[model samples]
Target chain A: MIAKPLALSLLLGALAVVPAAAQVKIGVVTSSSGPIALVGIPQKNSVALLPKSAGGQSIEYIALDDASDPTATVTAFKKLISEEKVDAIIGPSGTPNAMGVINFAAESGTPMLAPVGSAAIILPMTEPKKWVFKTTQNDGLVADKLIEHMVKTGIKTVGFIGTADPYGDNWLKVFTEGATAKGIKVVTAERFQRQDTSLTAQGLKVTASRPDAVLIAAPGSSSVLPETTLFDQGYRGKIYQTHGAALPDFLKLGGKKVEGTILAASLMLVLDDIPDTNVSKKLAVDYVAAYEKAYGTKPATFGANVYDAGLMLQSVIPVALKTAKPGTPEFRAALRTALEGVKELAGTQGVYNLSPEDHSGFDQRGLELITVSGGQWKLLK
Target chain B: MNMQIVMLLGQDGVTNGAVYALLALSIMLVFSVTRILLIPQGEFVAFAALTMAAMQSGRAVQLGWLVFALAVVATLMDAAKVWRSKGREPWPHGTLGLLAVAALALVLTKVLPLDRIGMFAQALLTIALVVPLGPLLYRVFFQAIAAAHSLVLLIVSIAVHVALVGTGLLMFGPEGGKTEPFSDAFFEIGPAMIASQTLWVIAATLALMGGLWVFFGKTLYGRALQATAVNRLGAELVGISPDLAGRASFTLAAAIGVLSGILIAPITTIYYDSGFIISLKGFVGAIIGGLTSFPVAALGALFIGQAEAFSTFWASSYKEVIVFTLLLPVLVWRSLAHTRVEDEE
Candidate 1:
């Protein structure tokens, strides 16, 4: 009688463990505080809105804060993969943090969906980056559009002022290549720290070069300083900013000084004005309405990248679940394959069509030009 | 470079150097008076700037309440100390002055229509709220350990700086702030047009330096501060209270920091921790002067500003490296030239 009871108990325990292992886990690492919190907080909030279950399988998300640090990002990634045994990871916003973990994720066969705005993270689709994908539009695509606008407006020479970090280096490379390809001479390349209080020296140096147009390549509020200084010094030339200035606070802080500044941003920023036929229009409207209803404020463009990553994972988990159990290494590989096979899926930023060679799946159609007219972003005609 | 370029660079450098010079002077003052390095000096700059930006934007800043609370804590501490000493010393005059300043700040922040006021008045209100924080900080954190070893005091200062930075994040949030230019008029000087704000920086720095010169050379209190800085124990023996001098030095440092913040906020976006690096740059200038001579420190800071401007033009990526690397050679020379004085154990 004792032996029969023991066998029945063991069978019940074994049955419980099998179903628990089938529940899919997704890990997220993003900066929720510190200097980059402007982007991180929104990303964190959006991830919370993801559906709890997909295709009859329960889904669990484990989100961690990286504090906008590359070291913390790596630590979070390691803990999630090894300790939590998450099948896939999303985010570690900012280019440097995302790039820091790409190799590890690829070598470990754990799929990562990075939400930063750098193309270099997924470009040249090599062996190490095969497991890594990004949701934001590529910097190269945005840079090309900005340069094209400049060329059309008779801008011959341009000055570039960016931060002295990997993000800035990426911009320098992309903008330089894009401008040079368009036959526009980049007269001066000046760099500043993101926390810099004054860019007077940089302003003087760049203005002295007398470029017809200047690209203030720093992100968020840091971008305003160079432009304001150059304007104050009486450099009456056209200025272009990157998509990083999409947040409305950039205008509140910049005030009247930012008026007339043009930038290449995702169409989601001005959802009402986006062409109805654009692939991203319906997705943008839906996202804006859902996000506004949830957060009581219009979502930042950076948050859209995180939301898109969530959608990507939601679409892939069902297909991957059909092949293998959730916690096994084979299941992680299956998820990676499914993510790469994603096709014609419309997201808030653009329609993602992932492939072995193109991880971002965004092209020139992903961005639009907008100008700050009267404390509002106006779509360029 | 052409004459026009040279003029523009010079203007930029001088304006930046003037702000650095004020910071250097304040650092020198605090170090010589108390033997404690004020590491959070730059935090005061950021706090003042953000507070002003908030006030100017029609937001009722909490700085007034913060100052009021600190003043209350500092006053109670003073009262307790006096009671323990059997009321031998009269109720502290500095405490009374702080209470008065705090009350004024409370009224100004609460009663005044900050948005209707001009930028100048808004800046003055910011200065008023920020300046009293200095002596209050001294009373709360340093007064009890005024005679502690310089290294210990320096550690405390770093702790204070880190704590303030955290608080700053909570108070100001992570987003950076920029204020409208105090004056938008442009004045053409020789080959370049200079913003009037730059001119204001130069004028304010010079005026403050001159005021300091007069105070040191003429007044009894100034002489007492100088004497205390020269020989702390001796000045104490001569009946000049070291506590008073320390408080005065901190007050002056706080004023200088707030002034610099107000001047620079319109030109650059300032975040919470931005002050620490700016302070480090000023410390470099102070070190070049051996932290003693005001003129040499001012000159060193000016050189740093000019060098930074020129370096950005030549090699933008290496500007900070160039500014920091300058300290190495100067430090080596100072060590070789001056005889080391070991502290008595």
Candidate 2:
């Protein structure tokens, strides 16, 4: 009688463990409290709004804060992969943070969805980079659009000022290539530290070059400094900023100086102007409304990048679920394959059309031309 | 670059150089008196600027609460120290003063229309809110370890800087801030148009430097502090409290830092983490003095500012590289010139 009861109890225990074992686990690492907190805080806040249940499986997110340090990012990635056994990972917010962990994610066969700015994380598309995918638009995509606008406006010569970091470095590389191809002469390129107290010398140099337009490529509010300095120095032709200047702080800090600035960024910046027929419009609206309700403020485009990462994972999890159980190595590998196979999937930022070669699968629909007029972002006519 | 560019860059250099000179003097003051490297000197500048920015935007300044909280912690620490020693030593000297200042700031923030107030009042209020932090921090972090070795003090100083930076992030969000310019008028001088704010920075820096010169030369407390810096044990035997000297120097440093912040906030954006690099530049200035002479340090900082400005014009990408590379030769020259070995302990 005792043996029979033991066998029955063991069967019940096995039944209890099966469902718990099948739950999908995802790891999220963000620089939620440090230098990059402007980007990381929104991404961290959006983590709560990510779908808890996706593709008939309950998804569990394990979040970590890297404090904007790259070494801490690697540690977080290792802990998540080794201890939590997370099937997929998202974020490690800044570009350098994400770039440091691509090898670890690949070695563990876990897919990483990085919501960072630099395209260097995915470009040169090495074997290890295959496990990593970017949710933000590529620098080249945004640069191409800005360069086209410059051409349309008959801007022949351009001056560039960017921060001396990877974000600026990549923008300079991409903008120079595109401008050169379009036969626009690049007159001067100056760089400044994000924490620089003054940009007077750079502003004077760029103004002296007398380019038809000046392009600035610093992220967040630091982008405002160069533009304002140029304004103060009487550079009047035109100013073109990169998508890095999409934050609301850009307007608040730049004030009257940035009144006529133009840039191309995600549709989220000009959501009201976007037609309802656009693929990403409805989702972006819903996200903005939900985010505003939750946080009492409109979410920046950086937040949408992470939310899009969630959407991508939500769309791909079911396909991955069919091949293997959630806790095994096969499941993580299958998830990576499924994410690559995602096509025509709409996210809050843009529609994803992932392939083997392109991990950041955004096209023209991902960006909209925006200009700052009278202290607000307006869709460019 | 032509004469016009030179004038423009020179103006920029002098404006920034003046701020760095103030910071260098304060760093030198605090280091000589306390044997502690003031790594967090720039945090005061950042906090004061952010506080000023918050006021300008009509937001209630939150720095008052931080001041109040730090003051309370400092008081508790002081009380604990007294209880442990079981002596009738006087209770913490500035706790009451700090608390009063904090409370006054909090009340003013709640009652006043911060944005409508003139820039002068906003600056004064920002200074009031931030200056007390200097003494409170000295009490809480450094007072107990005042007699520790210089290396230990340096390590502890770094730890405090890290903590304050994290606290800064919590207190002020990660966004950068710029305040309204002191004045909008421009001064045209020979090929260059100088912003009135630049003139204000230079003027304030000179005035403060002169004021410091008088204080150190005329005041009894200042002479006592100087004596302590010259010989700690001698000053102690002469009844000049080392602790008092430390707190006093920190207060002066904090005041200088906040003034620098107010002056420069209109010129550039400052983030919660911006202080380290700014103060590091000042530290570089301090090093150029071999961490000793005040006038040499001030001159060194001005030279650094000019080098930084000209380098930004010539090779923008390598501006920082060029500026920092200057320190190598200064260090080598100082080491080669001064062969006398003094015991650190």
In the range A1-381, model 1's lDDT, one tens digit per residue, is 122223322222121011234388888887866668777867877776665677788888888887788998999899989998989999888888988999889878899999987888888788889989999888888898899899899999999999887768889998998898889999999998887666777887888789999998876667777877787777889999999888877788878777899999888777778769987798778877887888677778888889889888889888998999998899999998998899998788878889998899887777889998888999999
**Per-residue lDDT of model 2, residues B212-305, tens digit only:** 9998889999899889889999999999988889999999999999999988998999998898888888889999998889999999999989
For model 2, residues A147-243, the per-residue Cα lDDT tens digits are 9999999999999999998889989999999999999988999999888999999999999999999999988889999999999998888999999
lDDT of each: 0.84, 0.88
Lowest-sum lDDT 10-residue window in model 2 chain B: B163-172
Candidate that scores best on TM-score: 2
Alpha-carbon deviation at A105 in model 1, angstroms: 2.7
Worst 10 residues of 1 chain A by lDDT: A9-18
Q: Per-candidate TM-score, first chain only?
A: 0.90, 0.93
- lDDT per residue for candidate 1 within B194-249, as digits (tens), equals 88988999999999999999999999999999999989999999999888999999
